[model samples]
Target: MPLGQRPGDKSDARYCGVEVLDFPAGEDLPAVLNHSLASAFDFILVPLVDPNYRPAPGSVLPVSASDLILGPAQWSNHVVGKISEWIDLDSEDERLRLDSELTLKQEIAWASHVSLQACVLPAPRRSFCGNYARVVNQILQGLTNMHLWLRLPLEKSEPMDDDLDKIKNNSHTSEIVDSWELWNSFRLLCDHSSQLCVALDILSTLPSINSLARWFGEPVRAAILQTEAFLTNAKGYPCLSKRHQSLLTGFFKHSVQVIISGRSNHNVFPVSEGVLSGDESYAEDSRVRHALTPYLEYIAYLYRKMDPLPEQERIEINYRDFLQSPLQPLMDNLEAQTYETFEKDVVKYTQYRRAVAKALVDRVADDAVSTTRTVLMVVGAGRGPLVRASLQAAEETGRKLKVYAVEKILTLLLLFIV
Candidate 1:
């Protein structure tokens, strides 16, 4: 009952509500059709590139030449002969004769004229190719128009002088007149004026602005103030309208916020309202840590500077405290292990040592061996697990022992030493 597949071998059943099957090359058409019927399939979606699939000779015939012109017509002809016939012409001359006889330039002009005519018409619609040609023509025409406008002088010509006077006399109308004059002058200059000389003149005038500013600084400032006043009062100007003005103000405020905050609204902040309240699902504490890392280093630098101790004393104290920390026992344990045991045990010891080594290097110089010895004292000599391990390492390595046991509980210290 699925589309395109017949129900059974019975002629009546095959004809009754079933659709016809489409087969490709190398496929056993009868077998495929039979399989589809047995499976109750109305249609099979097969690719044109499949080895078993070939469309019938005229199955894909296009309605017109426009459709046939885009793709591989030769391969298309082999698959669909009707399309080939529709597109086939005796010669290029015949094809050209069938179409308009305009050259490329004339065709462009004609197309633009057609589009301009269409634009003026009510609900004008064109075929796809016609639309494409019209669009190309419209663009070319726009460029041509612009070039023509640019050819005129910046100052008003004879016919435009009346409009210019009307604009200058009425302050309210000046902007519109100025804009129109500028645009028309630009167009005329582009089309008829010597552009190279105009460009050179423009380049030469850049230094004049600075020279004028130097000579008449107050005049420049006054002119700027007057321009601002004009813009504020320009009723017809889109940017001076209340809504647009508010929108621009909002945009400027947002831009300032983005600059000060170091991120735009779209970027995630390190500490946001939702994150602070634990309501944000994707808040990463690591990002906060990353943002604060430089600040943390700065704090540490300030703390060091403000410390009461002399530099030498601070170095000694830091080194002694670090070396005598719990890290010593861990290092001794790592050094005592066999190669196989070391592989397993050394990782933890190495991590601890590296951390301590980095801290020492940052706080004290590399030649501070006295501080290392002080660290050994701070770790203590009592027979705790750490102390016992250190003793065992000393026995194995035949190294001299120096240790200090600091325990608040007298009983535990006594038991440890014993």
Candidate 2:
């Protein structure tokens, strides 16, 4: 039924789900951010900007004020605190100077109030030829010990050169580009905090997802594997090339905790996962939900194939926490997709029905009539899933109710009514 394509027969009150906003890099600095919080957004994703990049007198950077966030004012929320990305961080002189130029006094100050997870970034090459150590040390020192994530460049190729020859003669370790030398080098400096991790950026340019496993080098593997996440640039859906899809997913069998990012428009800045999914919604459909299903199922399939969890590990993980990962928690729109009734859909909705019934019930039996008789209205009614959920809730409560679904699309409305 594709959810909203037909009139909803169910009534639900918990249908007013949470919404998160995504703010792209632009002008208006504090205003946009403040507005997002004021609107009660669960979260806001601002593009990573270098707070201290000072272009040479003659040089100009292609960026805006919004792209240059100072240390954020401390607020209590989960923020992916990222370093400011500069346009041109090429050469040793520039790299060495980074230790002096980059500062996070304000950022850390903000973090003391709000929770800043990981510093998301692509490698910050100190020179055309340096391991990730220098840039990493700079972050460690600046943030005073925070988790650092290396989002292996998805489309950009690392500079390649003759392997061992350049090492002695040219003194260039461009060879590190092909493997985990950067991560390894950083390990030598690591104090072994939960702060060192990897965020594999899935892309066609990846030489071999298989190669990454070997590069992990058992010990380093165990340490950071416990501290891993995935990243990808997505359009309406995961921007995985057909050829790389299975190979990439298979490589990270349980890495469904991927952070999906994308450019919002012509300015070519990043947008939040929420906006990307909601903007691409088909009626009430979220693009992210579509993208999440198959991947999570794939992960579950992998889980079913795994060795049983150790009792000690199981004891540490709460029943709910067992599901937490680098990925965001499940935040679905709740309306079932009617057109495609897969086994997963049936399982999902059935569980949701049980939950709604449980959550909505009260000891006051007479109140059920008053509660269920309450009119249900769904604004921007995409397909009819919310309406149906509402109806379901009302029926479960044994209350009389009328549902008014207002949708801007006449064709969609007609389809639902018919």
Deviation from native of the Cα of residue 101 in model 1, angstroms = 68
lDDT per residue (tens digit) for residues 324-371 in model 1: 334344334323233233234444544544544454445444465334
lDDT of the structure predicted as candidate 1: 0.26
> What is candidate 2's lDDT per residue for 44-132, written digit by digit as tens?
33433344445354543323242235344322232454445542234457554553243333333344334455555445453242434
Q: Count the backbone clashes (under 3 Å) in each candidate.
A: 26, 20
Candidate-wise lDDT, in order: 0.26, 0.41
Q: Model 1: how far is 333 from its true place, Å?
A: 25
lDDT of 1 at 235: 36
